[model samples]
Target: MDERKYNMAEEVKVFSTWSSPFALRVIWALKLKGVEFDTIHEDLSSKSPLLLQYNPIHKMVPVLVHNGKVICESLVILEYIDETWKQSPLLPEDPHQKANARFWAKFGDDKVSSIWSDVLMKEGKEQEEGVSASMENLKYLEEEIRGKKFFGGETIGLADIALGWLAYHLVIFEETLGLKLIDQEKFPSLAAWEQEFANAPIIRENWPDRDKLANLFGVLREANLGKGTPK
Candidate 1:
């Protein structure tokens, strides 16, 4: 544990949006590490000046400010948190396993956004294509966690935190869109893992408001696709 690197007295702030999965990733990581930090929720419609200043390039939430230095991007922040606070290890101790965890975390990051936009946001033919692609991507993940309780084995880890959206928010997406993307029959392991992940103590405690998220997604889907709310 390198406590010197992360000054306990200095400010540790997380600029994030409540509905953002990326932001939730940081929140989970911080909670898992038992790091005390202040959360500043940003209104994505009109981002805050602090968010812009901290993450000039992305201009997005989940910007972690430690002391005075800023770390943007959820995965990067997770890594920074893990490195800075080594109490509850987020990554595997073995180098090979750690690399594998990073790989899947990156995979989840790369694929989840597209899945949300294409599958959840779009409709008709586009959404059908997105569903197929998402299933394929999820199949790969399913195999990765085929027998484990979580992507990080018995306990949650970096990859599990990275893909936490799948456990919590994806249900809201399904309800809002009235689509079943992660069926228990189709992706049994992944589906089972979802329940286990969401039921975890820290995750359950910090879970987002389901109805609020569903309503938000409903509005976003309508605005993005120019279609009335799904039945």
Candidate 2:
């Protein structure tokens, strides 16, 4: 919390927010690698001067400041973490495998907008179409993850950390809106991965408070739908 403390001992510090899955990615990676870092919580509503200085362009959370060098973007931070800490690699050694991990991570991010615009913020035929599109995208993942417990075999890897947002976000979105984004029976592998991901010790510990997120998104959904923020 104190600026002076940052310069005192630890070389790693993360600018973060409580509910952001992006921020959590950084936290998970650091913990997985057994890196010690201090987290400075940011209030997005009132942008901090320190955060702005560290990440001048995006001015966002999950900014990794190591030895006075700043790294912006969550995905970039994950890569940085992997490279800096040799223990518990988030990516594989094989080039082809690494490429595959990057691909799936991008695939997951590209789908996020659709969830917000097409599914979460729509209704009637539009919402139905959104759900269908999501399921179709998920089907690809279903097949890919069929035999493995995680995206990169048994251990959590780049793709897992990158797309980890979905584990909690989709569940909260589904519960708050009463819309089924995923049918566990239809997407058994993906469903299993989601459950396994959320329950994993590191993930479970770093997760945003479930009830808090549920309430926040529930109100957000209502506000977005012209439901006037349920009293």
The candidate scoring highest on lDDT is 1
Clashing pairs in 2: none
Q: What tens digits encode model 2's per-residue C-alpha lDDT throughout 1-231?
A: 553454356689999999888898899998887777899999997989999998888888989999988999988889888897777999999999999998888888787436877787788998999888988888888888898999978899999888787788778888877877667888888888998888999888888888998887767767888987644
Per-residue alpha-carbon lDDT of candidate 1 for residues 7-123, written as tens digits (9 for 90 to 100): 467689999888889999999998888888899989988898888999999999889999899999999999999998888899989999999999999999788657888887778
Per-residue lDDT, model 1, residue 128, is: 94
Name model 2 segments beyond 4 Å from true.
1-9, 229-231
Q: Please give the lDDT score at residue 165 for candidate 1.
A: 89
List the pairs of residues colliding in candidate 1.
Answer: none
